[model samples]
Target: MVKDEYTLVLVKPDGVKTRHIGEIITRIERKGYKIEALKMIQPTEELLRQHYADKVDKPFFPELLEYMTEGPIVGIVVSGTNVIKAIHNMAGATNPVEAEWGTIRGDYGREWPDGNLRNIVHTSDEPSSATKEIKIWFPEFEFTQG
Candidate 1:
């Protein structure tokens, strides 16, 4: 049997504000991932800081925080075989302009007027990130590894 893996998927503020949550969720489900838990939240700057600790000092950090906290985001625990990679692929490149067609970013994300990173979804890029993010996004939810 294929052991199931889990990923933390978040449809960012822009996605919700633009009403792309349904389409994004539909794509995840269509790809065979299971959403074990989900919630909408207006994330804190502190949480964003911790989440992007490595990039917190970068110039774009403030913009990232402001953008992320702009509105409510839908966070989901997505599970399946190789879900981390699958979700990232679906999210496309960090810059929507470089993303391929059919990807979530390519399909709906648009470049900011100033060329900022306005890609819609934020999916964990690795197992480590997934583990950390799952905790931050769903602290009370319990998860079991297969």
Candidate 2:
């Protein structure tokens, strides 16, 4: 799994508003990864609809969509060895309350309006997901070596 790899990294609205963009990017780069593509965009309802479409029928879907569209987010494509799994480990659990101390979620998140945990980041959960998400968020951008 050491071959060239890429994963999507998002600096959620909270992260961006809190100025954690630089810190998050530093963490990834310090781990020997390269950022391939990046953008700051306010996602549309349709965009969020497609991105989390799988969770559309879930109980938390509405709130999640609203939260995502609340403000601008930094969407990025990062490349390196085992980047998908690496990013997931760095992001930690979905529930910040249960996330490990050193992970991004644990350090920056708190419970949200609906009593659900409001982690400040999102990482693709698998290789297939990474591919799908990167395409969804950065369709025009292509991965290249740094």
Candidate 3:
């Protein structure tokens, strides 16, 4: 088992403004995942650009970045067994309309007719993404040795 494996979870701007942070935390806890560290942040432009570098060329990327910076986000380091995949499943799809009913996005998020995706949460895609996202979001954080 991969003990202490962690994933980066971002309760996005919409989630924060909607006061869904508590429910999100509750669900994470209910799933038996541990929150190692958490904070609210207003991400800088450079940080987000780097984080979403791959999408920079896409037309919708600007709106995506703008939406992310609209409000403060709750960033958390969540530890659990196979958290990368497990958390992804719990978060559901990026588009709430297509997400499964029980998942976070499906349950709490809404779909806008203007084609904007208002998904409430974002999780690291895999181990590599988790590592990169952790570094981007929490550079000063040091992992304690077991």
Q: Pick the candidate with the highest lDDT.
A: 1
Clash count, predicted structure 1? 0
Q: How many backbone clashes are present in model 3?
A: 0
Q: Which parts of model 3 have CA positions greater than 4 angstroms off?
A: none
Model 2 lDDT per residue over 1-146, tens place: 34778899888888888888998988999999988888998888888877897999999887888788778999988988888899899998888889898899888877767664457888988878888888889889775653
| CA lDDT scores, all candidates in order | 0.89, 0.85, 0.88
Name the 10 consecutive residues with the lowest summed lDDT in model 3.
137-146
Mark the regions of model 2 whose C-alpha exceeds 4 Å error after superposition: 113-116, 143-146
> 87, model 1: CA deviation in Å?
1.1
Full ranking by TM-score = 1, 3, 2
* TM-score of every candidate relative to the true structure: 0.95, 0.92, 0.94
Q: Residue 53 lDDT in model 3?
A: 82
Please report the TM-score between candidate 1 and the true structure. Answer: 0.95
